[model samples]
Target: MTFSPRRPLTAVLLAGALLAGTAGCSTFSDSGRSKYAQGEGKPAEDDDASASASSSAEAELPYDIRPLLHPDKKYYGLAAKGAPASMKSVKEFASSTGKKPNMIEFYSAWGDSYETTLAQNAWDYGALPFIAWEPFKRSLAGIAAGKDDAYIASYARSVKTLNQPVAISFAHEMNGFWYSWGTKKATPKEFVRAFRHVHDVFEKVGATQVIWVWSPNVINPMPKVRLEPYWPGDSYVDWVGVVGYYARTGPSTFPTLYGPTMDQIRAFTKKPFIVAETAAEAGDRKPADIKDLFQGVEKRDDVLGHVWFNFDKEADWRISSGPASARTYREQSRSSRYGFDVTKP
Candidate 1:
């Protein structure tokens, strides 16, 4: 969930630069979204333990994550910075926005396990955690040929063990050329093979707890590249997560940034779509862009939810990036369309 190509930086420049740099509640991260989840473990609030008891390391999941990936349900939340080492720490962070996130997103490298302390924290808090499982180090061709099976298998086992429901966006934004697994490094055939292979292994391990998401960056980055070729088929994905950003100077409306990608995905899949990552730069139009984003998503029946990349890096992508941006975000998030509720009772 990053913004490397989030804005209107020409796609070519973004790909060349992202060899350079990088959401929402019903909650998002880019540039290794989980890169910031490195906080010291703190004791969960007194009730956090009890609240999450059902989603314990061994207990069966208490809720279904499939709905978040459905073509109709709505979700809203943030890609919070700074990891909370414990469920308590996660809860505290979730509350910082004055509203709990229903969806929590992060990133993972090849070696990280599927069921993490952070995942547990998120599940305990009643938020459905989504992971951008990257295929770094290992190429898509190698993954298609079982090169990362050991790592994939271990992660699959971990998900089965956790038993709680979560979403996994494997090799996200593959159409973009910036990352190793994207257009620059792998062909559409190789990407599909790798995706199915991973999904197959997960199936073998009985990791039904995972909701598969096939996320892509804005098509603007690779306008000439047809996204259809990367499709792993309807069976392989449960949701479509798209990433985009409003530029400080370029087209900063929801329609301009996300419309093209949506129009393309709809032709092929009926799966629900989620704004896996999006942010408006801290500029004159940030507030308006924020309004447009929420308003647009609210009116769309196909969009199930959106994840705001609340951090500030190349651009102040945070909700509080501008004076009224944060307030606008809150009002929009509280709207009826924003189906955020991590602490579901």
Candidate 2:
């Protein structure tokens, strides 16, 4: 779950900068109100005949993310520095792995404007944009009490205006104690309330295009803290994102790392899970660990995919850290079962 924190500078600085230039901007007014509203700001219902007609009359978009909702093949993704903004690192990763990633993962701090450029870049590159929306300076209790409604509403509207599918993993790795929203700073009840509140705001603004991913760090490191207490119910979650890493001191095999966590999750909900963040350490055993990572994902039907933490932080976790590891990654990840055209049906 650990990687170099490369916050998107352009994205944070130029929030909503694309709306005025993009063709989708035509559907919104200068006030940024959605055209879907009718009869003096009445919200449109899915079953409303007029609303249905309005939706059909909209121009066709290039990105179609339904395929990613229930992907027949595992998603090949990467989390690297300057991704979705530059894609230089992503391209290098693709070159080494012999295939372009179908999903791009990035981090977004709270109070920053939605990174429309990041989303656009991911779609333009034939990939899905996955955001790890971290509420760094904000308190979970204050968030739940609607103190941040204005900010949340503005952010959600930006996503709605884009009208493209995006996956958001809000306040990820909450089960761990290192982060502000984790066990040390916040309670499970407070976390659940804050999560539900954010999800509700997005729903109220008709940003239903988002795929809500509830991610938590693996339980192996913190066996004392249970994950069930933080559950925000099934309605608010579309995917269970599990975060873990293969380290020399930690669990090296997939079964030892993710099995117990997955087993505990199955006791509550049947939602499909993904290895949201993972990487192998740099060492002689990295090649074998890399092979095991790919093979482990390939054999699990419920595992949607994994996003490799391709950055050198704390340890050499990059895929190209060593010749043998790089070669093994290229060879093991060539499976036809790993990546697919997310834009296609």
Candidate 3:
């Protein structure tokens, strides 16, 4: 993430409740169903009338899943971390960038009864939704054991309503020691089982519109907890997303920061690679770092895309934090390879 939850580690927000109710619905209430859309753990029909309206979306149904993996197209996305998850706000943020993001990123937590409002809006705006689903205050083992099926099923149906393709990444950065699912607190077995279990439920409920992204934090800093042991395999993933940043000062190149980790990932799967979260901290080389970061990834044929973390915390990571940095980004995005062509409804 561009920024993390301050309480992901020790916060047990769901202490006595099995799940959040209407009182805590997420940014998905635009359709009024996110609040009352309950799952009895069974597939429910939306009726002939609703289905008729959805027929158009259904025809547009199989939503183009190729852009994310197009062999010749390079996709560029954005993650406005800590910002409102509404489409209106998302558009305003993108407008400020002088470039629109092909994908808009949002966040969700385990047992957090949320809806797909952002996803719907992103689709309407021709942008793919990239959801960063977290497993806070819960153990991976419990999720893998089918304890979270009802919640997962409900989410699946909601996406089914979306009727457009969306990308879902669960427990991102599992190898990092900050969250409960990190290597120090959970085993690789638990992580793999939980991921497969969630994907299986999504499959069972017929939420095939989803594009699964197996995301992990870079391992150059922690070789002991290699990302390979935690991978759920090709059949379970459609994309390989990695998160790494240039947090230091002085001049540096992209390979210097991400080459070794990318090499390690190549040792495993050939899934399309996405720099799910990346930024250059405001330091001695903030301007140069931004230039190298964009140019470096732009030159890689194997990189499907890159998402910039547009936030102003923990070292002014926002592109506008520095004038030179912002200018470089705006100019670089003018390239034809910085794909902004999205599918709109």
Candidate 4:
């Protein structure tokens, strides 16, 4: 369903009266009822009315998702080394070109002894580091269970030491069929709870440097189901992210994925958005496709930036340089995509 804006309310107050002569401990108090009514409290309600009202409010104003920013007008980020061996080479390429790699989506799972090596490499290269935490893997199962607050707390503390902005995408592509976060086909409410719980730990530890990117795959046709249940409260997200990959498998194009999905995400909240991940496969990464994606973004002030997934992990990446990826990057990097004059700004 397309999202509609919610109504604004004012002057909330408690409705119930206190019992003066109660000798036993009463579960519901006048202040408690009022707190629940105002959404400042979570009380067990026997009647569905109160619960329903609170649930509806949650659906509208869910969690406190953050806003992602780019101080530079045209944000240039590179994906370096899904594995350790490639990091040095990728970093060398970006440094030669004078662009600090904005963020690296490290494919390291939790508790890898080699992570210290990878983290050190990122620190030396001056790269913003991020990793996909795969707790569902057997070795990390306990951490994924949501019962391990201590585990999350410890990880948050460790990441704080890195002193670089880290985006810990626990289970990315949650809206896609691939990940266990949405593996059971959780309901939207369930998804919201799980997603928020992870953030709750980070927030509690005051890890404000961490910019949460709720990344999902672009809406797809059947045989490839889209899992919307994994969408947490807008409050839980810092940036709305979609992974858009172009393929010759069918009628898919960059526009077919990026444009409409951006529209769908923008329909509900005004949070800044990003093309969390992407790769093109079409002939020369057609200018028309690049134009379509930018046209969809230009007018909207809410849309912040796009991160071109810069890797050749897949055989169909269609990657090229201005000379090498010339046909593709040249047309794709036109000024409109950045929405600001890099020269002037």
RMSD of each: 11.6, 7.7, 9.5, 16.5
Off by over 4 Å in 4: 1-72, 82-86, 92-100, 111-120, 123-126, 138-145, 183-187, 222-229, 250-254, 282-301, 321-324, 330-345
Using TM-score, rank the candidates from best to worst: 2, 3, 1, 4
Summarize candidate 2's per-residue lDDT along 281-301 as a digit string, tens digits.
789999999999899988899
Please report how far candidate 1 places residue 311 from its true position, in Å. Answer: 1.0
Question: What TM-score, computed on C-alpha atoms, does each candidate reach?
Answer: 0.79, 0.85, 0.80, 0.63
Compose the digit string of candidate 4's lDDT tens values, residues 187-294: 445556666876888778755546677776666532244434556667777777666655434334445566566666666666667666554444544444445554
Candidate 3 lDDT by residue in tens digits, 1-345: 324545331111100111211111112221322212332232323545464554433242233344345535566677775433555645655666666777777778787754566666666666777888899868999999988899999989887666667788899888777678877789998999999999999889877767898888766556677878898989999988777776664226788667877888899888878888777777667788877877887788777778777766545677878788877777777777776455511
- lDDT over C-alpha atoms for residue 115 of model 3: 50
Model 1 spans > 4 angstroms off:
1-64, 71-73, 84-97, 340-345
Of the candidates shown, which would achieve the greatest TM-score relative to the real structure?
A: 2
Task: State the local distance difference test value for candidate 1.
Answer: 0.69
For candidate 1, the TM-score is 0.79
